[model samples]
Target: MLELKTPQEIAAMRTTGAFIAELLDDLQARAAVGVNLLDLEYRARALIEDRGAVSCYWDYAPSFGRGPFRNVICLSVNDAVLHGLPHDYTLRDGDLLSMDIAVSIDGWVADSARSLIVGTPRPQDQRLIEATERALEAAIAAALPGGRLGDISAAIGAVADEYGYPVNTDFGGHGLGRTMHEDPHVSNRGRAGRGLVLRPGLTLALEPWFAQGTSKIVYDPDGWTLRSADGSRTAHSEHTIAVTEGAPQVLTRSLTGAGLP
Candidate 1:
């Protein structure tokens, strides 16, 4: 069932979203060359503990996942894209990394993801990250009242298409509120005026992920990490947004307006 958050609930979500934004910003800064992926998870766990928040990924056991995901954060490096399981690998210079996180604060949940280059960035890697960022912004802009879910999906697809990237519809955005995932699955590609009707109080996590070479993906033996079939680098960007009477409220934006990129 589709659940619409009340104004009060949205306020609560804003708090959680802000915390996630700040956390991501801090994590991104600490994700330098030579940093271990497991270390990133530990840092995220400590932050969650300090804030008295709960990690949505810690016990997450979706059907597609291996079992309960024991990590506090996802660390997708280079060819790895979504649902990345943190392992004992050290980041290297020029490595393209993507992090996805979700946390619950005071019963409200917020989810977001970002992709960045560890040190010296390659031109193609930079372009992939930028494309996903722009796609995320476009989707958020389309999350206004009176719009349809497809509007957001179409907006995301348009940006990826413009960059000549193929859209992977296997896993996309989803309704979000008290839980980490909910109804109204938002695809990365769709017609502009179709799907569920948008309204006030509707909150969603809009994520756009794409690969440089092909749309096909291969699952890791760990049963959590997802990688590009062609060994091409990929990027993903996401933000939690709420539909309002006017412009959509981007809850996952940092205090300084820093966001996915």
Candidate 2:
């Protein structure tokens, strides 16, 4: 069922979103060359505890992945794009790393993801990252009352096509609230003005992810990491937002800065 958030529920989500946003920012800053993926995970675990929050990914036994996620955040490097399980690998120069996290505060949840290059970045990888960022921005802009969900998906597909990257629809954005996943799955590719109608109070996690080479992805033996099938690089960008009368409110974005709000 597609549930619309009441004002109070929305406010609670905003607080959760704020914590997640700041945590992501902190992890990004700390993911430098020589840093281990598990190190980042531990940091996120501590931060979540500091806020009296809970990690939605912990003990998340989804149908597709291995049982009991047991991690606070997802760390995908290079060819890996989604559902990555953190390990002992240390960051290297020019490595494209994606971090995804979802946390609950006072029973409200917000999810967000970001891809970046550790140390120096390769030109092609940088472009791929920018493509997802642009696509995410476009998708956010399309989340307006009186619009359809397809508008957001179309915006993402258009940007990926403009960048000549293929999109894999197996996993994409989704509606989230009290729990992690919810109704109205948001595909990365769709026709404009199609699917469910958008209205105020609807909160969604709009994500755009792509591979530099092929759209096909293969699962790791770990049963969680999703990597490019053709050994190509990948990137992912996401934001949890709410449809509003004016511009959509980016809940997972900083509310106290010129860059956000």
Q: lDDT of candidate 2 vs native?
A: 0.92
lDDT by residue (1-261, candidate 1, tens digit) is 899998899989988888889888888889999999998898899889999999999889988988899999999999999999999999999999999999999999999999999999999999999999999999998888888999999999999999999988999999999899999899999999898999999999999999999999999999999999999999999999999889999888765555323
Model 2 TM-score, 2 decimals: 0.97
Tally clashes: model 2.
0
In model 1, the Cα lDDT at residue 147 comes to 81
Number of clashing residue pairs in every model?
0, 0
lDDT of the candidates, in the order given: 0.93, 0.92
Residue-level lDDT tens digits of model 2 in 131-190: 999999999999999999999999999999999999999899999998999988999999
The C-alpha local distance difference test score for the whole of candidate 1 amounts to 0.93
